[model samples]
Target: MRIVIFGGTGFVGLNLAEVLLARGHEVTLYDRAALPLSAQRSLADYGARLKAVQGDITDVDTIDALVAEGCDAIVLGAAVTAGEDLERVSPARVLEINVMAQIPILQAAIRHGVRRVVNLSSASAYGAAGQRHQILDEETPCDPVSFYAISKFTSERSAARHAELFGGDFLSVRLSAVFGPWERPGSVRDTPSLQFQILAAFARGEPALLPAPGIKDWTYAPDAAEAVAVLIEAERPRHRLYNISSGAAWSALQWGEAFAALHPGLECRLAEPDEKTFIKLHGGDRAPLSVTRMADEFGWRARFGCAESAAAMSAWWMQHKEWI
Candidate 1:
């Protein structure tokens, strides 16, 4: 299958691209700029199953043509990341980049006879506080507090509309905090969050950040990417939204400490806590639209489980310092 990925230059996209290529699928990456040096080097090592095309998301006709050129499906992974300066970025910019940009692309794909589209959604759409492991699912009400979350939610709605209005098949996956190999340095590096801090400090040969409260259900990137590919290959579903995750909880410190134990000299220490940073973990009643559905419906399962995957990532990063 020929699959097209937007924003395939970044960390998650790079991992996804590699996985798709390894599976013997032809991959064309559409991005505004050339891939980073590391990505280029890795692509060279991985051979030519993958290729890159330069294009802006704003170019509707170009995107249409690309989709029409024997590409069976579209995977929308492009988006401006979360920002600290929300006001400066503005809600308008978020809508333009995340929401509006996806519409013309999806419309063009439908017009050009693309069979399916996999839109990447986010857990942040639940808003500022979680309902104590509320088991946030596809049916949960959206109360997006951040511009990034709002944009992701709005994009999913737009994709669903495209599916309903134009007969285009679509699957939107609400991904949780995703981390694994091929992660870009500086993106999560030095992050105040306990897990990343520990990972980052160890990477830098420093002390890991140890904290009890920073928790998240971190899906492994390769696993997450595999889920996206599976959804694209599946039949159109009555239920269009699914949460792709490990669906398990762990503190940032727990993850960091475990990784730290793997390597000597790297150790973890607690930093001063910030009340605002605590995540409201969702609860059990919700039964997050399990990837078990993907498994049952499409024969999908995580290639790597959470803790083992995190350790693999740490070891991979440690060995390939040049890649980071």
Candidate 2:
């Protein structure tokens, strides 16, 4: 299969590209940012099976031309992960990139007869509703609050509506808090994951301070990528929406503590009362996303937990510490 991932140079996109390329599929990454040198070196083994293209996602001509050439599947991973600061300063930019730009891409997919279109959405789409519910399922009604959350929810509905009206095979997956290899600070992404922050502190030879436990069903990037790949390869999925999650709750502090134990110089602990800390948690903890839909439909479940992910990510950082 030939797959095109928008925002492919970003964190999750690179992970997904590696997954697809390893499965003997050709991957084309379309993004404005250049691929990081670490990623370029790591992906070098794939040879010509991987291609990276630099272009503005809003440019319909470029996107459509690429899609028309021959695309078996499309993954809509481009987004502006805005926080309150960005939302206050550039709200329109958030909606434009996260919502409006997606329309042309979806239309191109439909026009070119692309087999499957998967939209990457965030668990933030659940918003305040997440606080009310114990388990967020695909059918849960969303009450999105932040600009980023609103855009993701809107994109999900727009993609599903386009499929419904045009008879296209479009689907959306609501991903839980994702953090693993390849996550880094960028222009579009204002908030780095807690795990990334902890790792960065470790790299700086400083202790990591936590604002809170930062508990949530944090999904590993590779696991989340594999779930998206499953959807792209499915012959005919039963539903239009699925929740990709770890299916359990854990704290970033726990993972950090586990990681700190691996290295004698590392220290990860909660901040003292009223003490200033560099680590920033996204928001107050909310309900974990339910993976029942993914499990029932495809027998899928995230393989990594707090301790396992800590070990795996520590090994990865040892090889590519420069990436942090």
Candidate 3:
């Protein structure tokens, strides 16, 4: 299969590219940012199977030309992960990139007779509803509050509507808090994951100070990418929307401690009273997302938990500490 991933230079895109390339598929990575040297060195073993193209996502001509060439599948991973600060500074930019830009891409996919289109959404789409509900499923109502959340929810609806009207195979997966290999600070992504923050502190030879026990269903990036790959290749998906998550909540502080155990002389603990901390949690803890739909349909479940992900990330960090 030949697949194209928008925002391919970003964290999740790179992980998905590696997964697909390892499965003996051709992959083209389309992104605004050039591929990082670190990624180039790591992906060198794949040879010509991987191609990275730098382009503006909003440029209809470029996107159309690329899709027109040929593609077996398309994964919409481009997004502006804005927080309140960015939302106030540039709200329209968020909408333009996260929502409006998707229209032309989907249109091109439809025109070119693409097989499958997978829209990468976030659990942030759940918004306040995530906090209110004890368990968030596909049927749960969403009251998205942040600009990022609103754009994600809007993108999902738009993709579904396009598929319904045009008879295209479009599916959206709402991913839980994703943190693992390839996650780094970038222009579009304002908030780094808690695990990233903790590991960054470790890289700097400092104690990881936590504001709180940041607990949520933190999905490892590789695991999340594999699940999205499943949806892209599924012959007949039972549902249009599905939740991808670890399906269990655990404290990121615990993960830090686990990593600390692997490396001696590193401190991972809570901040003292009245002490300032650099670590930033995404938001207050919310209910974990239910993976029942994915499990039932595809026999998929996240393999990494708090401890396992910690160990895996520790090994990755040892090799790619410069990425921090």
Candidate 4:
């Protein structure tokens, strides 16, 4: 299959591109800038199966040509990374990149007759976890807490609606804390409550900070990439919103202890956040759509556990000197 990925040069996009290429599909990566050195290095491993193109999502000509270049599916991974200050990328720009850009692109795809589309939505859309006990399934009403989440949720709805109106299939994957190799710099200092926290602390030379004894599911990048692939390959009705997460919950202290044990030199601290600083969890009680949904239906499984994923990421960062 030939696939075109918007924002294929970033973290998630980069990982997904590799996954698609490994499956022997022709991939065209359209990003705003040249592929980063890390991504270039990884793509080198794929040789010629992948084509990396630098292009703007706002450019109609660019969008048309790329869509016309022909692709069986399109994955929209292009957006501001979560945790970014919404004010940093003004609402106009956020709406432009997250929502407006998709209009032209989706129009192009519909005109070009692309079969399927996968929009990468964020778990942030559900706001802080643990705010509610019921799991946020596809049907849960969203109360966006930040500008980033608003843009993501809005963009997803727009694209999915467009696909429905135009006679095509669309699926949205709401991703949890995704971490792995080729992770962009920054945030290595203070990781999230989930997987990246330990890795971040190690990278920043700070003691690891674990969350209060609260539960949150952090999905590894490979699992997420596989989930997207599974959605692309799955038949229609089965294609609605799927929560792509590890489906396993762990507390902050547990994660911190595990991480501290892995690296002897690293200091592990049990520090609580100040009153002003609090972490939010998307607490949904419902078991995420069972993996059976992905396996029996789409043939997908998470190959790495949290500890295993953390170790693998740490090793990669150490190898690249990214964790210095």
- The segments of candidate 1 whose C-alpha lies over 4 angstroms from its true place after superposition are 185-196, 210-212, 272-292
Could you tell me the C-alpha RMSD of candidate 2 in Å? Answer: 0.7
Instruction: Name the lDDT of candidate 2.
Output: 0.93
Backbone clashes, candidate 2: 0
Q: Give one digit per residue, the lDDT tens place, for model 3 in 190-307.
A: 8899999999999888999999999899999999999998998899998999999999999999999999999999989999999889998776778899999999989999999999
Which lDDT tens digits does candidate 2 get at residues 1-324? 999999999999999999999899999999999988999999999999999999999999999999999989999999998877788989999999999999999999999999999999999999999999999998899999999999999999999999999999999999899999999877789889999999998888889999898999999899999999999999999999999999999999999999999998899999999888899988677899999989988999999999999999989999999999
Candidate 1 yields a Cα-based lDDT of 0.70
Q: Which residue pairs of candidate 3 clash?
A: none
Better of 2 and 4 by lDDT: 2
Residue runs of model 4 more than 4 Å from their true location after superposition? 82-84, 128-130, 185-197, 210-214, 235-237, 272-296
- Any runs in candidate 2 off by more than 4 Å, and if so which? none
**Candidate 2 local lDDT, residue 35:** 88
Residue by residue across 285-307, what tens digits does model 1's lDDT show?
22233455666677676666545
Candidate 4 C-alpha lDDT tens digits along 69-135:
7899999887765344443545567667877888888888899999888888877677653266456
lDDT for 101 in candidate 1 is: 91
For each predicted model, how many residue pairs clash, with residues at least 3 apart or on different chains?
9, 0, 0, 14
